[model samples]
Target: MTNSIKPRLLLEIIAVGILAFAGVLTKTAANVAFPAMMAAFHINLGTVQWVTSAYMLTATLVIPMSAYLQRSFTSRALFLSASLFFTVGTGLIVGAPSLALVLVGRVLQGVGNGIAIPLMFNIILMAVPRSQRGMMMGVGTLITATAGAIGPTYGGLLVDRWGWRMIFIALLPLLLGSLVLGLVTIYGERRPARQPFAFLDYGLLALGLLLILLAQNGLGEAAPLVSLAEYGLGIICLFLFAYRSTHTATPVLNLAIFKIAAFTWLALTYFTTFMVFFKYVFRPTQ
Candidate 1:
């Protein structure tokens, strides 16, 4: 901490951080509520698990679009949209009578999260002074980490007392606070891209991701041949998506960043570690 920071500047970061935190918290907390959710809907474990899957899948798909979103829209617009999507999704989840609606709500929440996460980093880099960026980035990461860290415990306690929907209900005030703070603190600045949307790139990417997730989710249950076909198709789609991204002039994702040897290795390391840990944590307890 070399130099002192402006109050409003910090508030701006706090606004986005809170939004991101809420999104992360929702995702993690809902996992603890799965048992309650299944009982409430009279569904089995596999079926109820889609609540988390729908949310994660939607978030994963939307994440790749974040780079494009930043290029096309103002930070203020994006944050506001995120807030709205999240709020509406929470509402739907709280009021849902059927599992179908719950899944839809989770998907909407995922969309909000996917936007808020990248947008948080975008804002920090764009708004925070270079000297203070590291600290602010840490603050942002702390907010996210804290949310995920305590989410399971928080959900467990709340679900035990007030039921599964209470997990979302508890977030209403936080969501409103974020929206209000965003209105006051978030700025409107746009640097629109001058490039055509490459439908093929995003199409392949989305299809690939969907296939991969579906195949993974259905691994034990689905027929061997079907699973193999899906895995094969998914890999091919991703390969095409990557090839197109590298070769295109206005790529949705800048694959060039991975050209840095250190960065590529670090990313792979992080991905593999997170995947292993994630499976361990999310595994169904027998």
Candidate 2:
């Protein structure tokens, strides 16, 4: 029984790992095409970078809402829907003849990727035994790091060989395979639905994303200080979000999670670690 259970558990881990890898793949696939996109669209680097920036902006804004969605929908349903959205978005980008359509596709991809990432974490927590949680987390970290290490090089090679559209094409099979596996192996677990959604909080999140987009567009060699201001404004908006989330009845984020001392300390530690790692990884001189 123990031997049989081990193999089944390994299969589950692989399934989740593949799904998580798809998310990283989507993010990295576009890196090589960035320059091509700018040249083809006749847009400046700052404007064209929105292809990446918009995805990130949308992801950041939408992630907080995933808690509510998770409450209402099954994991299988959420995973399937997110995968479909990502796949559709990639298809659109592959076929897009115009810049506007490309941007639209990227926005959709961002939303899908955003929802999928946190859901992956949730899946790991729920599926793995407590005794093995640390091991699973280590596995996840390794997968993420491996993806990051290779993504840029791989993307560059693909773009050099096949052009920008090829990146989108590359993702289709992976997404389809993951979607099928997710449906077959992942069971739906239900939870009570969240109460009526709050419109104001949603609006604020949208505004914050817009501000981030603006900041990303504005910040470059041509206008560094102005871009900084735009980014600063976005940070302010995030603080506003925190305040509103705490005060409102139908908050988008559950502030109650921080009430636990362990949760709070862990969150702070994670934030610090993330900051250090990110700075080291992305240092300008490097």
Candidate 3:
């Protein structure tokens, strides 16, 4: 039993590792192609910023609902859905004639990324023994980090050689390959107990996140007073979202995770570190 289980865990790790690499690569790689896209699409930097924001916001909004989705669908079903969304989205972006269509494609990719990321982690935890989970997670992190580090340079080279659309086209084979592995290897994976999704939980949570992200992104573009008001409104919506999440029996955002003091502190630390690093990095560029 142990021998058989170890090989299965290895296979899942390889599959999930590819997913992780693709997720990180997608974000970092697209960033480098922004200048090329701006020139080709005949758009200003601000307008083209939506290319990244649309994907990020969609991913952020979808992440909170992942648990609900996992419960509503089988692991195999979720994996295939993620791959399908990613593949179709990449195709659309590659062939898109307008910024609007590109944004739509990006949104689809973001949804796929959101689902794949959490699902990959869940699969690893379920497949690997507890003793090996830490090591495997470390390996997964390394894969993502390496991909991220390489993405900007790789994307730039591809864009320079073949044009901006090539960025999306380049990943087609890898995405399809991951899908094939998933189809073959995801058999006998765990299934979740069925749960009916609540509109209140999904809707408010997404609305709150969307408002906050938009407000933050608009800080530099909007007038000072308007920005302030938008920020205030976003905060209010977030507060309401938190209240609703806690009160609801089946909270989509899972506020209960904050009950763990360690997680709360760790999360705060990460947020602060990110903010500090972001300002340090982007302040000079601006």
Candidate 4:
């Protein structure tokens, strides 16, 4: 029994690692192609930055609903869907005839990445034993961090050697393999009845995404006031989302997670670290 379980656990770890790689691939591809994208589109630095910023904004806006999605779909179904979305988006970027289509592809890839990361964690927690969960979690974090660290360098190399389209093309096999493995290993593990779709959640998500888009566009154009207003509206939507999440019985995001002291502190730390990093990166040097 132990021998058999070991192989299965190894496979699960490999699957999670691959999923993390896919998430990192999206970022790597974008970073690698950013300079080329600007040159090809004849856009300035600020405009080209949107290629990455838009993806992040979209991902952040959608990530809050991941818990609801996990409840509504089987693991296999969700993983497959994420793979397909990511692969299709990658294809779009590869075959894009215009900058607009490329941006659309980036947005789709962002959604896939946003969904896949949390789902990977959920699957690991479900499959791994309690006694070994800590080890698995550490491994997962290491995989994620390693991917992030190497992503930019790999992307730069690919873009330099084969042009920007190769970055997208490179992801196709990984996504397909992940889809196949997920179907084999994770299918039929759980069958929660799908709940009725919530229109309110969709509405709020759309509004939030729209605000992010507007803000990105405004910022690109150097319209600080317009960007500020757009971001302000986005904050309002987030507050509304928080209120609905907490007060409603069938909340999209489980607000109760924030009540855990550890989670609360982690969230605070993450926010501070992100702000500090961004400030350092963007600050003008003398």
For all candidates in order, the CA lDDT equals 0.85, 0.73, 0.76, 0.72
Over 109-182, each residue of candidate 1 has an lDDT whose tens digit, in order, gives 99999999988888888778788889888888888888887888888889889998999998999999989988
lDDT winner: 1
State the local distance difference test value for candidate 3: 0.76
Tell me which residue pairs clash in candidate 1.
Answer: none
Better of 3 and 4 by TM-score: 3
Which is the winner by lDDT between candidate 2 and candidate 3? 3
> What overall lDDT, based on C-alpha atoms, would model 4 receive against the true structure?
0.72
What are the runs in model 1 whose C-alpha is more than 4 Å off?
A: 1-4, 190-194, 284-286
Clashing pairs in model 4?
none
Q: Which pairs of residues collide in candidate 3?
A: none
Predictions ranked by TM-score, top down? 1, 3, 4, 2
Q: What TM-score do all the candidates reach, one by one?
A: 0.95, 0.82, 0.90, 0.85
Model 3 is weakest, by summed lDDT over 10 consecutive residues, at: 277-286
Per-model root-mean-square deviation over C-alphas: 1.8, 3.7, 2.5, 3.3
The sequence of per-residue lDDT tens digits that candidate 2 reaches over residues 1-286 is 4213255456555665665676566565566577787778888665666676667677777788887888878877777778777888888999998888888898888778777777777766766777777777788778766765666667777888988888778878877787777777767756657568867777776777687778766655688887788778877777787788898887888787899999999999989987685444332110
Kindly list the per-residue Cα lDDT of model 3 for residues 86-136, writing each as its tens digit.
789889999999989999999999888888878777776767777777877
In candidate 1 the C-alpha lDDT for residue 41 amounts to 89
Candidate 4: which stretches are off by over 4 Å? 1-6, 209-213, 220-222, 275-286
User: Residue 215: error of model 4 in Å?
Assistant: 2.9
